[model samples]
Target: MNALSIDIEVNEAHLRQQFEDCSDIVFRSFKLSDGAMLLLVYLDGLTHVQSVEDNILRPLLFNGLPQGEKPVPSLAERMKREWLPLANVQTVDSSDALVQHILRGSLGLLVNGEAAALIAQIPGFEERSIQEPKKEATLRGSKEGFVENLRTNTSLLRRRIIHEDLKMESFTIGSYTQTEVVLAYVKGLADENVLSEVRKKLGQIDMKGIIDSAYLEEWLEGSSYSIFSQIQNTERPDIVAASLLEGKVTLIANGSPFALILPITFWSGLQSADDYFERFVFVILTRAVRYAMTFISFALPAIYVALSTFHPEMVPANLMISIATARENSPFPTVIEVFIMMFIFDALQEAGVHLPNQLGPVGSIIGALVIGQAAVEAGIISTPIIIVISLTGIAAFTIPRYSATMPFRLTRYMILFITGFLGFVGFAYGIIFLLIHLVMLESFGTPFFRPVAPFDGRRIKDIFIRYPFWIKNGRNKKGGQQ
Candidate 1:
């Protein structure tokens, strides 16, 4: 409410009441030529200073009013067409529009006698320029990314899809923050229930701010307590558009680099945008490699523990002899040694992520050499444990979504704990428990483990090894089915 004031045909007293408790507000009394009333407003950065001087002040002072003013129309209409930067403001009786205008980065101008005041739309802002998506990059697709500007991000989608049916619906979720959020999906392709569920969940959020899509996403889909992110987060518009085409819903919020792709299952997380970029054979091979890595990231430590501790004969005879010889000098039990090494490996990975860009590689090198040499020298852990931990870290990195790797990282520990206690049975129990939890999870009311649990063969074209482009028909047949 930082507006310069002069009420011409408008109630000055009532205008004051509209902005009563607002402290940032400023007002100045002014006059128009030939005894006519006039008011001007500059709400901090909401009104451009230059535009106010040229469009508003200069016109009122220099540019003669409708010359023979027969009482300029309504206050709102007069200011909208006649005033410079204040063109788009709407006037209301209950102070709602004025309040809404102020909140939306516009300044309101009130005048005496006239029922309406000028509301100018001049949104000054600081936002990042479009850049390559850091998290969701694809070799063969669009390089453009979602910026902080919500309108600009939506425009990015419009540019790509270019369909009138591809709708972008907007709303504000936070109570105090008044953050803007938009939902984009193809009209007929996207499920109404999915969209409704997303909107309902977002409306239910009790938080004071919506700084990132993850906040809305966490509130909207799956359990907040689960380790896996039930909603897929991607920055690529192509990926988002693809999801929309397949009846998946997308949530884009102001001030977030990523968009939320709903109903993201375990398999969806494993698949990447790049999977569609490559040929069928290569895509399937890469998919298999990623699946194998998921197993490695989770079960390797437990399986190793199980074999070394309980089933020595499980390892080939030659391999068993070598492993036993290596562990001969180790002072700690295999379980403790394995657990400690895994902890160190995890510490190094987390540190690498959080450290300065320059220090990240250095931390990795230090973790590799310093830990390996010391553990082997002290006989606290065998050299082979270092290899296992290193491989586990690499396996976790293979998955495209970094967040998805976290659950597997957690799984690795559970697998270790289980193996340490009940050997193979505990390992099996952990895996089964994880599957049950995943099956229990639903993203926007759709099963998290979609195709596999739903047992739909038609969706396999896009799920497992994607069929050739000609054979695939470029649609998810199961998406629209009940």
Candidate 2:
């Protein structure tokens, strides 16, 4: 609605008024060799002065101005076509668009009697250079990771997957932040129904800001109430590319290094990039260990409570004697003892994480060695309980993804509470309840407990074990069609 006037001074005045208090806004007016007036407007820190000067100013000054007395439209057209030698240039007719262009680090050139402003692309701002992914490091894959810049991140994905079917659709979310989010997928590989659902959910997001890809994970997911993450988030572009090749959609948001890969199964959380890189035999063994760790982390405490309280005979005679001897000096019951130890373990883990990086490991060592040993020596806790809690903590570290670790921790507490009340029966009941909950859960309309719960034998090869590349069933070359 705010159309530019033919008067150069009037347009400058409007710009000055709009950016009154902003001292960083620059408006430099100059005259061409032929006495034609023009103004250059940009934000100081965001624009590269040298590039603008060399690309735009130098070309205009050396080439001379467009000749003849013509209308504003003709002059503007002539300027766009024959004048500015910059790579990216556009003409803006309204003040609103002009301001937007300037804000995005483009140089705006307004001519004396022209009704439009010429925009030149020369954005310059400091950004973190591409580096190895911090969170999701791979032993044998690409070391390059996604950076904060959206264009750079998309480029990383593009480089790995060079194909015409690899499509990326961008959307602007966040009313205040106006953050850019791109949904990328292979056109035919990804299910149309899943794509439709994802787009619909994305359109429904009306937040004031989406700071990270995690912000979109919950909002885009069907079941927000579930503790388990239906969508997977990773920092590596190779992982994103792999997911895209496997008929999954990836969401990359500006200002965030993490990208979300959707319609992922519950088992996907347990899988890692390392699985694909390692030999199939070694991968199976490694995965088995991780799966065992997950189980131990979630059920160790509850199983101990159930067996010791209700079925002490289940334990070996020598171990039972040792456990009974350890607990003899402790005043609290078995459940209470376990609870205290778990709380202390949780607190120490939290402290270790939140503390300064230098002190984090030191704090963990002191808490584990000093506090735990002191507690046992004082008979405040049993040695066996300490050992169990320590094992549980260590097992949690084996899981590749933090999102999967959370559900393990949550389910552990739930199982512990149930076992404390009804012993072995309650432990079984809690696990059954959890299994049912997981089976009913859905991720982007895809089954959360896929291949395993549905018992798809053909697809099970990649679920628990990674098959060798040569031996694996191949997906169709055209978009991974089954």
Candidate 3:
């Protein structure tokens, strides 16, 4: 009794009634010669009206059947003989085929006394053009990004790879939303273990709707609460193609502008789109600056906290008394003051992101001038703390991937908390904990801390420094070889 039951006796009228609210469904009746009755229903966006008319309707109406002929054999023979490559029609006894056909962008044909309907699988979608990337925009690289279409996106992949081995498999997920998801990879390039793992993870995501590629990333990635993004999400088709070449599998969702690239590590997040476009020396210097900024974003406040209470000897003699005098009238501890300022800084950043473009500049001006100037003038905070907070905010923006910067933003607090309680020793403990946690993480079966934890000198050449293109040796247009 626990098993699910199907209501087979439910007529087309009942099924139509159940799905009447769905605006995309179009049900049309086709009464052929020889008293043959047929019902057709298809989705508006998915199926083309022209294919329905030419291949299916016109043919079935003119050359459907003879007056005294049996239905099954005649219909089956016509389908087998007449429809060349395009029209793929199948016979269905129960309502399952009709349901599936309608869901899969096919026109369903139901006939009287035939015990079945002819399900014609014809999917023709009008997809939009690829967009320009938003977050990862590059002045020197290709500007074209991905759009909210799977076929168009796949075609973009095809344009990039152009190899016979580049393969794509399609599936529809989400019971109600019916989102189209594609699994794409170069066949011979991708490792079988990782490919199988990708398929397995995708298979397990049973949900109501997939609004974007980010949704799929959250559902299919290894951890639920991990701060880092295990599945690399990119908006550019070139990035997708590049990742595919490197032996990574990409999951492209129907309504998502971003595609998911697996086996991404910390170094991948640090890399920008312009790295390959610019000269290697520029790339190396910019990368070093970004790394320095990352450290400053995380360590500046903690250093201030440590110096204020525990490590006063570290500060210059002239600067120590000014800082001490600034805090004399303040009620909060140094760590508390640092935490409050950091929280306000993050709030301003969030507000700037959410507000209209016109209002954002005003928010920045008010935050920078009114808050910092007024707070210092009012003697509530030291001028030095204001400078430190400003520097930290600027440093965070240097990181190319916004998500990669999140770990540092979070770890800053750990540093502050530890520096407050146990001074330098506690700060060291926090760093060890972070490094160990990063080591424990895996990005699609690849080490999250790649080339560092394993100590590969060849990989390290490109890690901290970007060598010249000739010195770059090989581009792993296939994923792991590089």
Q: Model 1 segments beyond 4 Å from truth?
A: 1-29, 64-71, 82-87, 474-482
Residue-level lDDT of model 3, residues 409-466, one tens digit each, is 8889878898899887888888888889888888777888888986788778888998
Estimate, for each residue in 138-217, the C-alpha lDDT of model 1 and write its tens digit: 77777898887888888888888888999888888787778888888899998988887777777777888888887886
Candidate achieving higher lDDT, 1 or 2? 2
Give the runs in model 3 whose Cα sits over 4 Å from its true position: 1-11, 17-24, 30-35, 45-94, 112-128, 325-329, 474-482
| TM-score attained by model 3 | 0.85
Each model's C-alpha lDDT?
0.77, 0.87, 0.79
* Predicted structure 3: lDDT: 0.79
413-436 in candidate 2: lDDT tens per residue?
899999999998999999999999
lDDT: worst 10-residue window of model 1: 1-10
Better of 1 and 3 by TM-score: 1
